[model samples]
Target: MQGLKAVLPLLIFVFCVRAKKMRWCTVSDPEHKKCAELAKALVAVLPPAAVAAFARLSCIRASSTTDCIEKIRANRADIVTLDAGEIYSAVKQFGLVVVAKEIYSDGGCILSVAVVRNSSVDIRSLQGHRSCHSGARWTAGWSLPLGFLLSRNYLSWSKEQLLSQDVSTFFSGSCIPGAAAMAPALCTLCQGQKSYIRQKNYHCETSHSEPFYNSQGALRCLRSGTGDVAFVDHLALESIEGSDRDQFRLLCTDGTQAPISHYRTCNLGRGPGAGMVTRANFRKTARKFLTTAQTLFGPRGRERQRFQLFNSSSFGENDLLFKDVTDKLFVLPDDMDVSQVLGLDYVALLKGLGHEGSSLEDSVVRWCCISYAEQKKCEQWALSIKSDPLVCVRAVSMRECIEKIKRDEVDAVSLDATHTFIAGRCGLVPVVTEYYEKERKCVPAEGSTHLETDVLPSVVAVAVAKRSSRSIFIGNLGGRRSCHGHMYSPAGWLLPYRHTLSLEHNSSSPCDPDQVYNSVFWKGCLPGSQGNLCKVCMGGTGEAATKRCADNHNERYYGNMGALRCLVGDPSGKSFGDVAFLEQHNLQANILSLSSTGWADGWTASEFELLCGDGRRAPLSEWESCNLGIVPPNTVMTRPVLTARVYDFLMKSQETLAANPNTEFKLFESQQYGESDLLFKDATQCFVHTSHMTARSILGGEFYSHIESVFNCTHSDILEFCNQDICSIFE
Candidate 1:
């Protein structure tokens, strides 16, 4: 037994040595044959020292590129070459690593282009034209051309049907490989293998069995009068020899044509070329193998008489193991990943083409609504706009909406100044500020003088009280009942008690804002508050009464309008709330609306008076001077990546609404829903793109300082959660 144990370690080492084989995956039978030839050629040419560093070479056949990706991920295969689009899937979905990329004579990128026999047909009006594509889902042939056409509104599609079906209908006929089952009409012009007895059934396949399978075959399809146009990359145009190549013209997006060589000016888009990928840890081994292959059979190699790495014409195929146009194999940086290899623009192009798997959501701007009333208004507004699709997503509170934006469950939400600050901290950026002024944009012009009506596009926080409340002033309101919009509200909660609590000065008590409000007020209606803080809060009416003291519109005392209703002594004759703290932007309109809506039977703007911070009383019109602070206006907030799209959608929707006045729904007006300021402030007139303005910059220095005074005292749940390490990635 001791003698056998000594040989056990040696046996295991021998077994491991025998198991070390590097397998190259191929998608087609022709590709498999070419790979086997290349493997044999490498062994015959490599020196002993160089060959010792690599394992024995072998070939594995896969049904398709996707199958190859799966095999490599499962350790059944070790290396493979794929185009940029398939490389995106291999890395993003299967966690494969790109080790090297093909560099052409021009660059390491391919320009997608459309080729035609003549310049007779306009590119934009190809509704009934016959088309030829290299292969279904290929970058240049399908994704870039279709995506560019869709973006330019040259073709129409809906999420309900497959994009393949739409393309089949758009074209009279086509020869798109790998689309035999998805859209059979797309393969009507495809000529399958009819001469070979073993592969006669091959029809619309992504292999060389189908005569019109790849870019070279697609070019033949166009040249044979079987297809009107061929969609391919610049490499295909450059590879074709003879005077027939001059017969093809490049189709530009501007309804013009150029020579086939003018792809730089008349192309769809540029994308990365095919690349070699393997497991991350196996990158070095894969790199060594490819380096030896390139040195042996590359364009400048001495072994070109026996084998050629880039050319597959000897195997009766094109681009078998590597692209035929590959000039050399370039090793990527060790730290470079797929995104870096594809470039940001190419990655975004793939994402826009639905390669990221959320194309429907990417097409529309989903507005986040916080209440039933706001959702209803948003729905109406969505139905009214047609320039850009609008969808509504519901959340229970403003903070929930911001969280939803961060999680990508929703797109954008209109947030007040305080909530905007919190949303900014969570990686949501301001797209556009709600414009209230009539004449100018939010940011003043460079040389233009400030007009008399220029107010910097903001709302003023005002402390309002009934004229009959003679004893209730700002300084002597310790034991009085107060009406607040909601917990953590800027005007209702923060500004109202900014001076009284003096939380910034206190350090021993943990500076809890909730405890401060609970201690000062006797009993009041502060929505989202529990215990005595919500004692006077009137819940929703009818079926919604179960939502009493809720944080949303279900609570009767929830927002600016709700706070005003609370101070008006509630329609139920409950005289609990005394002083109302809210924004002064929609104050007069909300009060005037109360008389017609019957929420308050006799409430008028004249019945309320503004209370200054210095214990002086003034009329409601003097809010500009007697206000606590000038808070930034509500701004549309969305994810940083979505800021530009959201802004474009909003601007287009606003322009549509302005051009058609008779439209049933309004963007800024929400009083028609029996509530004031549902999705946005009722006083807003337009929208101003904030450009690169953040919440802090938009709020200016003074108001941001006041905001600091409020939140610096206490840490809320939002701050605690968003301040974690995970949130830093989004920021």
Candidate 2:
């Protein structure tokens, strides 16, 4: 067993050496085997730890570019290899830094075209044929070839003329392979070396296309194809030497003269490359990583060859590239302009911002604008600020406009104080303020203004469903409810009730019970008020019952004063003793309970006067009538006794008084006697004095007006009464 172990070690060593030699042959020239051996020896002399570290850091072993990126992100690798085309996309999307280029591999741009060989279809003759490229319609493959051909005057056609010729075009994932596999035999344009290598088995032809270069023998092989025309790299043409190559020729060159080519020089000006982007909050971290990479690789020739780092220039380059491709491809319609495309005003260009929700059509228009700007302005401005304008000009409603401004939908908006106030109330910021004297309007904003005075004021109302009790109530109650007066009169009536009720029930009255009842009574009096009555009634069995009593009294006293007064009157059979007995017991038999709780809880004269006064003197208008009518403290009252004849007389008198145009009622009176003795009265005296004055002047002409004004004043007075104790009620 020991001998076999030793032999196994030797065999393993021999196998490893053979494997190493095979690996060397795959990457190095076979004739330079000795050089390969020396290279291997030099590699071996390095520290074992360094060798392992290099292996660990290299990204060559990753399965794909995506995997390589992941390894780098995970801190498992530091060196990655990617196709030249992938570099821009990676840097723009992921903020990846390029470190080095592989030695001995000379890489340059190439253009490839698929065509039939030994045919008479020159570049000009094939103008209307379908074409394919390995990219979206708005990309370099589609645009570069067309730009090159047009600049050279190869077809003597305008872009519109070419499009009108019905030259069908498509973007495919694999241009060469797709062209070869197309159903109707369409030609394609692609990278020269890649296409030639991929379609080596197919008989295809190519031309040394202008505006680009290639060094592979792409033109030679493409010239031998069955198609009469093709796209080929300019550099590849220098290496062609066969009969197949002779059959093909240079259609044009981009000013760098080649034999038989006469194309205008293309200004391949320098622009910013794609941006190194990362998550917004991670920008600082990304910047750090990039800086570290630059420090390590910049002086080592990697900076010039592998990276073009600029802080603000990155996004601009991508925008320019997008614009160029979009313009050449004619993806957007010709009639549309920049404003229509980006939906923005020209001011956006100054502000360096873009709009959202733009379509491909809009994208094309923006592309044209950018193209024009680049040609005229020397491409100095950052393209990042340029975008489709159609999205900016869409008309929006006042509410929507306000909402969008608050949400940062547009950078700014011209709005009124109301809109600004609403937005501010909703936690939106207003950055500027503007005023338009011609339109007599003021807008709040900081920068450029776009006034849309044509917009109407948005409707402002508390909306309720048609079926809602609140809606019906508001409709029936004159649609204009006042908060002050209606709240107090009922409360004025209820304060006495609560005091009396508290004495009778031997318990403290519920807080604000009178106010609650007043609210319920007023709400229930409106049309369709039945629907909402349950809110107050649901809790009426306990504390709510007391509230209901106060509410009933308030309704009778304010809304139906005549009915309340009648309910307290006596019948013919009722004697004064019977009325007095009922009043003493606080019974409801002889007297109509003006309130739901009977006479014991009825409003008192002193209470009414107190409510009407400024808390110092009795009310000056109806004070005498109220005081004379008041029962003693703790005395229960019933309906007063009266004969049928007397009742009829009172009714007739009231009706006659109401009918007279000169009739009026006093609301208050002031003492005209002593200086030290100041006396105030109530509504009765006030109305009586006003009535006498009106009668002495022109009679009843002002009677209705006087009544209305007095009623209004009374309501105001009630509100003032309640206002004093409202805070205490809530407390």
TM-score of every candidate? 0.56, 0.25
**Tens-place lDDT digits, model 1, residues 1-731:** 35435533543443244335688998677888998888777666554433443337889977656667888999999999887777887888788999988888877888889999967977888889999998877878887788667655567666467778889999999999877767889999999854343234556776666778778889989989999999987898867778877888989988899988788989986667778889887787687667757765889755777799999998878888888988889877788756567764456556655566766677788889877788888998888877568889988888888877766678789888888888877756777787787665433367732111224477888999999888878766766788889877888877766655332333244345566667677788888778988988888876344466787787878888889888886777675588888889889988988788887788778888999988788999898889887777888887654665676688778778888998878877878877777888887877766735667887777877777776777767876655543101111
Worst 10 residues of 1 by lDDT: 722-731
Candidate 1 similarity to native, TM-score = 0.56
lDDT tens readout by residue for model 2, 128-175? 443333221111222334433432233333223222122234212122
Name model 1 segments beyond 4 Å from true: 1-68, 74-358, 439-455, 501-512, 543-546, 727-731
- Best-performing candidate as measured by lDDT: 1
Instruction: Please estimate how well model 2 matches the true structure, expressed as its whole-model Cα lDDT.
Output: 0.25
